[model samples]
Target: MNRPADKPLYAVQDIPGKGKGLVATAKIIKGTRILSEQAAIALPFGLPDKERRKIISQQLKTLNNDARNAFLSLQNRFPTKSQYVGIFNTNSLCIKTSTDEGSFVDQAAIFLIASLINHNCENNAQQSWNNNTRRHNIHALRDIQEGEEITLSYVFSLLDRAGRQALLKKSFNFTCSCRLCSLPIRESQRRDGNVQRVAALDEVAKHQRSTAPLQSLQCYHCVLAYHLSKYGREDCEYAQAHGDVATLLVMYGDLARGRYFAQKAASVFRTLLGSDSNEAAEFAAMARDPSRHPQYGFSMKWKTSVDEIPYGLGSADLENWRWERLIPEGIAPFADIPSKEHFVKGGTSKKRHWCFMGEIVKTKLLHPVQLEVKDSGDKKLALHFYSSNTSDTGNSLRPGQYQKGYTVVILDALQYRFEFGCGINQEDLRMMKIFPLRLAKILALNKEVREFSIRHDDGKRKCHGCGAKAAVASMKRCSLCLSFWYCSKECQTAAWTTKAHKTDCKSLRDPDLRGLFFYNWDEAQDSISFPLQVADDSC
Candidate 1:
């Protein structure tokens, strides 16, 4: 059916410092397609300069008079021997082409209108190549006001201000003074550090994706959080992280959350890449039917259908469910320390971290310190500390924290085969924690916290002070840990004094301890470590 023509979305106009660039003529809502056009010239990456010039010349000649004028009008950042070749080189955008065998290769193409959209470090518009339509589409990532410059990011500008300035000058032949690049010195340095940290996290996710998909998934979630904190979540990278997390969740048989993230991905893709783009369609389908994904059922441990999505949840509770929240205490003794075989075969376990508790039966202080510790099962094992942190040892533990029967909690615990017997090769001081209490007592408290601290459907809450089950509201919650409850001042005083709640409360206040319990163990957000900055009671 034929329809009335819509008004043009944008117009090419003079941008003070940017010369001629696209500017929004009318209000463009987020996710609305600003432009969708085919390339005038295309060339595969890694072609010889001579061959590239020849290709550009051929494609340029085939264009109509008006198209040729628009193509030639594009900025030539690098003025080559041939102006046509220079124009193609400067204006070309990356377009990925895949083989029949499902392998992808990079190709660069020049689009008439898209080539005129100027660069911005924090662009309101996103550019994408439509795999199905074989066209370049520009979509408003965020709502663009009429008369606002319609810009797209020219580079992955996760670089420091100096680096960004240098790169833009060298490659794009212009100095960028975008908001990010124009920040104050101190703020710029802080932003640069976050940039480096995000880059490092991305590398970690890539490396751990195969060996530790759970860890990789957590890292991707961390990336999403970083995106939320620094750049807004509407960024291209942030949208991609949503898809990455979705894929991992699906592989782990978490269809409920996988579909949720897929839905988020689909929404962002629709807004950033247009609904007709391959990315949007692919995620839309996955959100509708996650079981259709190639990696579906890779592991059924977290098996749940899309219908399992919780209803009537508040935003905070929804986030906790969305990011698989971990109960540090509950995970403590679920599995034995991983042996060398497990690590070598690639950690097939969904968890990237675990806690190993063992009581100190013997101690040997030397270059490579050794400690004989006993676990809950009364099984004794030798722990050899080959850690680079020489200052932190059993003696270095808090005055009363280390004792004969005191147990050490090692996060990301691993087992090794020593000449004497199978034991732990202690490394990374941050991962090791020496509780003043015995392993049995520590575990008992862990059990208590799991049962009593949390609210039940029946409104019953266990008083940390008296161990008495009471109405949830009748109990006074512990100021710290945010996990323990108390009955009355009388019970609270008695528990704090007589019931050993004093020492337990102190331990509960430890960020590292709280970090363990609240950290997402399933498909969650935020990858935590020691010196943890944990959020106050997420649930």
Candidate 2:
């Protein structure tokens, strides 16, 4: 493996508008550490400014001639303050340092040569704090060509152009003309929308991590997917997210997936931070024995040993398994289901849920029942139904469900190469349902009810009408759906007329639609049939 060279890979050079910046002197491949140097001066990050200034002044006096000169020469945005203190504040980097097992603290430090690197919204370099080595390491996030200005992101959050500009101006006292920031208005807004959605998903993960583990995992999985599409899983952020998924999986008692994610996290960390990094070594251990995690068995919902991992699964199936992306927490939109060519790659089916849904456009009741359906993507496919082992009559589906514009849903469905056309070969009547509404309308109802439905947390539920929190008995449920809640007759009327609860109430009347909101799809269990037994508390 090509690793960081012993010699410096960059040279401190003067750029046109940006003062002094680190310019790559040699081709730096992604994951190669360009620099790994101990901090010249380190201090706790959030100390009182006066106290920090005094400490910096003291540290300056302790440094030798060359080191002292280097620290003083760095830019001082706050020129009005003491020279050493101002320089420290202007160029300090926040790093994580571990004091003991499973405990870490953030500190501020200054790197003489590293601090000179310029900032960019779309930076090609990444900076990491190596707790084991007690050094700050700069790694190439992407391949860097010789003579390219090696840059790191000063604003790490998914902030838009204006937000990045404001932060850059406030902290670093410079305007960023980076490629992403310099994009046209319409193009920048489009990029910002995508980034903001990722950030929102992260916030959802943080809020639901403890209260709703499955929901939190869904958000993290979406965030990871976004990173994979944008960064191709090579960046530091990707490794951190992978490690987080591993930890969550172990906590949920899914040792099979926990071990897989842990192993991947370790590999990524080894590439970016080296095999010697604390992160790499810790994850490597977890991969070897997932049951050893501190949070293991918090919930045995997904209980399984590492040996339970399915063999011969294709890439898509493994990814679907990793994130639990189908059924329960994540409902696959019709367009996202695998095509026949992609799904027929041959794999051993694992113990997990798979759901496929679409709007019925045509139906055939010949030898085998079949339907032509259109998905959210507006793409059409055929569904050929086979007699299932179960003797149930699909919850006694009415004649309305057989008509055009009705929606059909199948669970644990497998893609098949049919003689007529490519589509799903659905068996198992217990895992399917046909609703009396357009696929688009039913999916919309799912989204709405998911967001506005009252929560069971702490005995207080939010009234979908007036947004007031009250105990269950104190609220009134929409008689049709038994889902939405209200505080008063007036609020209920407003929700029905203005808030458009009328349409939502109609679709949610179908018990299966409501059950989708309450099912624990993340729990590893036997395939279940509808009408799904929903808890009264789910309302």
User: Which digits, one per residue and each the tens of the lDDT, describe model 1 over residues 1-539?
Assistant: 01111777888899997779988888888878778888888889988788988888888789899998888777787874478767777777889977788888899988888888888888888888876668788888788899999998878856667777887786667888888888899988888877886778788987875566655765676577778774445676777789888887888788999999999988877767767778878899999999999989877766888899988866655665676522232344423443442232222233345577888887765445577888877788887767565675642344344557777877767667566767888677666777666777777776766676666677687776767789866778877556677888887788778877777888777767666555545433344346655466442
Q: Write the per-residue lDDT of candidate 2 for residues 338-386, one digit (tens) a residue.
A: 4333232323443445567788888866446777888777878888777
Of candidate 1, the 10-residue stretch with the lowest lDDT total is: 341-350
Q: Could you say which candidate leads in lDDT?
A: 2
Show where candidate 2 strays beyond 4 Å: 1-4, 98-103, 231-233, 328-539
Steric clash pairs (candidate 1): 31-271, 323-524, 324-523, 328-517
In Å, residue 411's CA in model 1 sits off its true spot by 15
Error of 1 at 79 (Å): 2.7
lDDT of each: 0.73, 0.76
Provide C-alpha RMSD values for all models, in order: 13.7, 14.9
N/CA/C clash count, model 2: 1
Top candidate on TM-score is 1
**Candidate 1 stretches greater than 4 Å from native:** 1-5, 98-103, 157-163, 329-539
